[model samples]
Target: MLTIWGRINSHNVKKVVWLGEEMGLAYDRRDVGGPFGMDEAYRTLNPNALIPTIEDDGFVLWESNSILRYLAASHGGEAFYPADAQRRASVERWMDWGFSWADAIRPIFFQLVRTEADKRDAALIERSVARAADLSAILDDVLGRQEWLSGDAFGIGDIPVAAYANTWFQLPVERPSRPNFERWYAALQDRAPFRDVVMIPLS
Candidate 1:
């Protein structure tokens, strides 16, 4: 059985948990960050003290995207992860892009969702939101041509990107008109794993 460490509300943790559910893999998840509080023992697994560390048998792993790739490859999720070199590289690129997107949008996310209203940085949030919209436009253009970020089918590439997208829409900021991106997101909403796990209220 796989053992995972992290709180469910975390976007990164939600990515892992949702992917696990998508793969139909049985696993145990232990809450370990964001008020759950990591102990000294947890440090041995991840020096960064980040949410979402996974142990598959004796193999311990951190970094949410890496864990998603590993599980997809190790399990029979090659349909999502892909076996072809070009296809796999495409998925990897989107996963990496998703991480970069998260970095760009996180400041806005923290400002609106995590911080108290009076304490929020309006200027910073405004700038970050602009940047986020610019970034989202790139996804919108790509999604306009394809059904999934990984290509024609839903796959590993969608997980990390969608995880952040979930938060972006849930935030109380004004979003641009992105019909393609909205369509893609609507499809993701129909997935059981996404609905039950990734689509939760942002904390």
Candidate 2:
């Protein structure tokens, strides 16, 4: 069985685990990091002391995007990962873009979800929110022109962004509207794996 160590509420953890569900893989997901705290066993699996580390069979892997690519390429085959070089690159591009997106929006998520209401930095949040909304416009523009970031069909590319995007949409802050982005996000909400795992309330 695949053993995954991470707290379920984590954004990065959500992406990896949701992908496992998407691929119909039954995994043993454990609570680690955050309040759960990492033990020596978890550190042995991931020296980084991160929220997510996966041990599949005897192969151990860290990093959510790396795990996504590895699992998709190994198990999902041509249908999920794609065979053509350009097609695969397109899928990878969005996966890479997710890192930047995560950086931009993390403050907003942290302030709203983790920090106390009275203790939150309103100015920092305002500035950070603008940054996040501006960065998100890139997704809006691209999604407006295409059905999926993977092009035409849903693929491994959509998982990370969609997982992170749940917070963007659910957050209490106000931001400009992006019809196409909303449309794409709503479509993702219809997926069972997305609904079950990624649609969870912000923590």
lDDT for each residue of candidate 2 in 1-203, tens digit (9 for 90 to 100):
98888999999899988989989998999999999999998898899999778989899999999999999988889878988999899899999998888887889899988999999999988988898799879999999999988889888999888887888888988879988888899889878999888888888
Q: Count of backbone clashes for each model? A: 0, 0
Question: What's the true lDDT of residue 75 in model 2?
Answer: 85
Model 1: worst 10 consecutive residues (lDDT sum): 75-84
lDDT of 1: 0.91
lDDT digits (tens) for residues 24-62 of candidate 1:
999999999988899999999899999899999899999
Name the regions of candidate 2 deviating beyond 4 angstroms.
none
